[model samples]
Target: MAARLPALRHRDFRALWIGSACSSISLWTLLLGNAWIVYKLSDSSLWVGVSTFASMSPYLVAPLGGMVADRAERRILVRVTRLATFGVTITLTLLALANVIEVWMVVSLAFVQGIIRSVEIPSDQALLANVVPISDLGNAVALTSTTQHGSRAAGPLLAGPLLATIGVEGAYGISALFALLAFASVRRVSVSSRGGVTRLRDVGENMREGMVYIGRTPEVAAIFILVFAHCSLTMSFDAMLPGFAETRLHSPSGGFTIMTFGVGVGALVGTFVLAMTTGARRGPLLLGTALASGISPMLMAGSHHVPHAAVGAILMGSSQAMFMALSAVLLQEVVPDHIRGRVMSLYLMSAGGVMAFMNLGFGAMADRTGAPILFFLPGAAFVVITLASIATGPYLRRIYRTGTAVAVAPAA
Candidate 1:
C-alpha cells in the first residue's frame, strides 16, 4: 500500500489529485444528469446518444486543447474550465427550478459543456504528469483513472435516489456544488514547471511539429491507434447503458446506478492491482486485461438477471482500467515534456471525440437492432482487434520487452 502511493508524499501532487477527484465527481454527475434527463424528455434511446455526442464533440478538436496545455499556464487553464463547468451546472439548476427546461435547451448546454471539456481534459492530464516525478507516474495515472471510474460508480448511485425524490433539478443543484468544490481544490495546485512557452502566432507550426513527432515514432503511433480503436469500439458502448437498463433490465432510474456501480467497483480493484505493479513488463498485463475486458461484454449481452450484468460490469471495468491506465503511464514516460500535452491530446481525441460519434451511431443502431446485438458486435470486434494487434505489431512487443522503459527527466 505504501509503495503504491508514493506520489501522495508530494504536496503539489496531493493537491492536484484531490482537485482532479472533485472534477471527476462533477463530470460524472453531469453525465448522469444529462443521460437521464435526455432519456426522460424524448423517451428515445437515440436522443440519449445525441446528448452525449453534444457534450463530447469537443474531443474532435482536442489537439488544439493540447496545444493550449503545452503552451498556456495549465493551473489557471484548469481552474477556468472548472468555473465554466460551474456556470453550466448552475444555469441548468436555475432552468430546472423554473420548470422551463426543454430537450433542446439540455442538448445545447451539453454541447457548450463539451467545448469546455476539450480544454480541461488535456490540461488536467498534462498537469498531472507535470506535478509527479517519472518514477511515480504509473501510480499517479492509476489513481487518477480511479478518480474517474470510481466517480462513475458513485455518481449514478447518488443520482438515482436524487432523481427518485427531488428530481433532475435537485441532481443538477448537487452537481453545481461539486463543480464549486473542484474549482476551489484546483486553485491550490502549484507546479514548478508550467509547461512550454509558445506564442499564439506559432500555433500552426507547433501543431505541425506535434503531428510530425507522432508520425516519426512508430511505437507512440501504435499506442494512439490502439487507444482510438479501443475507445470507438469497446468503450463507447457504455453510453447505451441507460437504454440497456430500461429495455433489458426493466428497471427504472436505479438500474443505471446499479450497472455503473459494478463498473466502478471493478475499476477501483483494477487501480489497486496496477498501483502495486512496479517496473516495466506491463505489456502482457495490458494486452491480456484488455482481451478480458472485450470478452466480458458477451456476458453482459446475455445477462437476464441484474446480478449477472453486475458481474460482467466488474470484469469489464477492471480489465478496461488496466488497458487505459497502462497506456497513460507509457505515454507519459515515452513522450518528451515539451510535446507531452499535444501527444496526450491525441489520446483524448480517440477516447473522447471518436467515442462520441460511436455513441451516436450505436444509439441509432440500438433503436433498430436492439441493445444485445449492439453489445455483442462491439465485444467481438474488440477481441479481434487486440489479438490482431498483438500478432502483427512487433514494434510494440519490442518496446515492452525492455523492463525499465520509463524515461527520467533531468532534475530542475
Candidate 2:
C-alpha cells in the first residue's frame, strides 16, 4: 500500500485518478442499466448483442482518436467527454422514466456515446503522460488501473441494488450524477502545453507508422498478439453471460449483473495486489497472471449453479485486471512519447476489435450449441495460450529490453 500511495501524492495524478474512477463507476452503471433496459424491452439476446456491437464497434476509429489525443488538450477532452456522457445518461434516464424508451433508440444513442468514448479513451490514456512526471509513470499507471478496477467492482454492486430499489431510471440518474462529478474533477486538472499541430493526414500515416513500429519490434508484436488472443477468447463472455444466466442457468435477469459485480470485485483486489508490489519485473508474472485469468472462465461454463459461476467470474476479473495493468505499464515504459498515443491506440484497437468480433461470434455460437460450450472452448484456448506465453516469457523480456534500449538511445 505504501508503494502504491506514493503515486497518489502527486496532485494532478491524484485528481486524475479520482475523476477517472468516478467516471468508470458511471460507465459500468450505465452499462448495467442499458443492458437491463434492452433485455426487458426486446426479450431477445440477439438484440443485446447488437446493442453491444453498436456500443463497442467504435474502436475502429481508435487511430483517429489517438491522433486527436496527441493534438488536443487532454484535460479539456476529458471534461468535454464527461459532460457529454452525463448528458447522454440523463437523456436516456428521462426516456426510461417516461416509459418511451425504444430498443432502437437505445441502440442508436449507445452508438453515439461510443463515438465520444472512442475519442475519450485515447485522450485519457495519453493524458497520464502529461499529468505525471516520467519517473512516476509506472506508479501512476498502476494506480490508475487499480482505481478503474475498484470502480468497476463498486459500480455493478451498487447498480444491482439501485435498479432493484429505484428502477433502471434511477440507476441511470445516479450514473449521470457520478459523471457530473467526474467532469468537475477533470476541470480542475491543468493541462500542460504539449501542443502539436493537428494534421488529419497524420491519423492515417501515424496509424501506419504505429503498425510498422509494432511489426518491426518483436516485443510490441508479442504484446499485441497476446492481447488479441486473451481478450478475444475471454472478454466476449460478458456479452454472452446475460443469456446464459437467463436461460441456461435458470437464474433471474439480475444474476448476470451480479456475476459482473463479482468480476469487478476480483479485479479490484488484483489491482491492489499489483500496485503494492515494488520493483516488480513485468514479464513472467504478467504472462502467468494472464494465463490464469484466461483459464478461469472455463469454471463458469461448467458450473451447475450461480455461486460457482460467481467464483469463476471473480478469478477472471482479477486476472484480466492484472494482465491489462501490467501490460499498460510495460508499454508506457517502452514506447517513445511522440508516438505513444498511436502505439497504445493500436494495442487498444486490436484488443477492442478482437473482443467485438468475439462477442458477435460467441453470441451466435451460444445460440447454436448452448452457453456451456461457449464458455468451455474459449476458456480452454486461453489456458493453452497462457502456458505458451509463459514458456516464451524470457525471450519476450529480452526483446522488450532490447527494443526499449534502442528507442531511448537516440534521446540519450
Candidate 3:
C-alpha cells in the first residue's frame, strides 16, 4: 500500500487521486440511490433497465469523448464536468425533496450525468497517464484501479444504511457534497499539455487509426472482444439482483444494495492483491483471472442463499478487478502514447455500452423466465468463454511478442 502511494508523491497525482476517489464514491452512491428510486417509482423491471440505459448511453460517444480529451485541456474539462454533475445532482435532490420527483425526471437527469461522464472518462484517463512517469505507468494505473474498486466497495456499504435512514433525497444531497469536494480536488492539479496540437480532422483520423490498429493487432482485438462478450453475458448480474432479492433470497429491497456491496468487497480485495504483487508477471495470469471473473457471476446467479450469492459476488468482484487492472496495464504498455486515448476509449465503449445493453437484456430475462435462469444461462456462457480464452492464451502471447519486436526494430 505504501508503495502504491508513490504516485501520490507527485503532488498532482495525489490531488487527482483524491478528487477521483471522492467522485467515484459519490457516483456509486448516486447509482444505488437512483436505481432504488426508479425501482420504487415504476415498480417494473423494465423501468430499471431503461433507467440504467439512460445513465450509460453516453458511452456510445466514447470515441468522440476521447477525441475531446486528446484535443482539449483535460483539467478544465474535468472541472467543468464536476461542476455540471454538482448542478444536476442538486436539481435532482430538490425535486426529490419536494415530492415532485418523477421517473422521467430521474431518467433525464441521468442522461445529462452520463453525457458529462463520457467526456470525463477519457480526460481523466489521459490526465492520469500524463501525471505519472512511463516506467511507473503500470503501477499508477493499477493503483487507480485499486482506488476505484476500494471506493466501489465502500460507497454502497455506506450508502445502504444512509438510504434507509434519510431516503433518496438525502442520498442525493450527500452525493452532491462529495462532487463538490471532487471539484475542489481537481482545481488543485496543474495541467500540462502532452499531445501536440489537436485538429478537427485528427479526431476522426485518430479514432480510425485506433480501430485499424486494434484490428491489425489480434491480441488487442481479442482483449476487447473478450471484455465485450463478458459484459454482454455476465456483467448484468446487478440489474437482475432486485428480483433475486425479492423472490429467491426472500429479502427486502435493501438486499439488492447489500449484494452489490458484496461484489464491491470482493473487488477491494482483488485490487489489494494486485497492488501488493505489482511486479508479478501478469500476462498468462491475467488471462486466467479474466476467465475466472467471467465464471464467478454464474456462481452467484446459481446461489441458493444470500450468503452463497455474496460469496459469488466476492469472487466475481475480485477477479473482475484484477482482470481489468491488468488488462489496462497491458494495453497501455503495448499501445503508443499518441493513440492511447482512442484505444482506451474503445475499451471503455466495449465495457460500458455492451454492459449496459446486457443489463437491460438480463433484467428483461429475469422479469420473464425468472432471475435464477438469468444466472444459470449467463454463468454457463461465461465459463465457456473463459475456457476458450485460456485455450488461445499461447497464441495471443506470441502475437503480442511479435508485435512488440516489430515495433522496436530499428529503421533499415
lDDT of each: 0.80, 0.76, 0.75
Q: For every model shown, what is its TM-score relative to the native structure?
A: 0.95, 0.93, 0.92
- Top lDDT model: 1
What local lDDT does model 2 show for residue 93? Answer: 89
Q: Is candidate 2 or candidate 3 better by TM-score?
A: 2
Q: How do the residues 1-412 of candidate 3 rate in per-residue lDDT, one tens digit apiece? A: 5565466668888888889888887787787778888877887676777778877878878888777777778888889989888998889899988999999998898889888888887778878888878777776777778877767676677778777787888778878988899999999999574443268475657677778878777667777777787777766665677777777787746667778888788888887677655443565557667678767876776777778877887888888878777777667666666666677778888888877787787777778887877776776787787676556665445533342212221111
| Model 1: how far residue 332 lies from native, Å | 0.7
Q: What is the C-alpha lDDT profile of model 1 across 1-412, one tens digit per residue?
A: 6655898877888888888878877877778888888888888789988998998888899889888898888989999999999999999999989989988998899999888989998889888888888788777877787777667676766676887788899778878888899899888888844556377568777777677777777777777888888888777765688888888898757677787778877887886677677665577777777688688887789977688888988887888877888888777777777777777887888788888999999988888888888778888898998888868887666545643333433212
Model 3 TM-score, 2 decimals: 0.92
Clashing pairs in 2: none
For model 2, how does the per-residue alpha-carbon lDDT over 1-412 read when each residue is reduced to its tens digit? 5545677777887788889988888888887787777777876666767777777788777777777777777778778988999999999889988988999988888788878887787788888887777777877888789878767777777778877677788778878889898888887787663334257565566577667767776666777787788888877775677788887767755678778888899889998887765454555557667778767877777877788888988988898888888778777777766667777777778877667667767766776677788887887888887676656665455533342312331111
Q: List residue ranges in candidate 2 displaced over 4 A.
A: 193-198, 390-412
Please say which candidate is ahead in TM-score: 1 or 3.
1
Show the lowest summed lDDT stretch of 10 residues, model 3.
Answer: 403-412
Model number with the top TM-score: 1
Number of clashes recorded per candidate: 0, 0, 0
How good is model 2 by TM-score?
A: 0.93
RMSD of 2: 2.6
lDDT of 1: 0.80
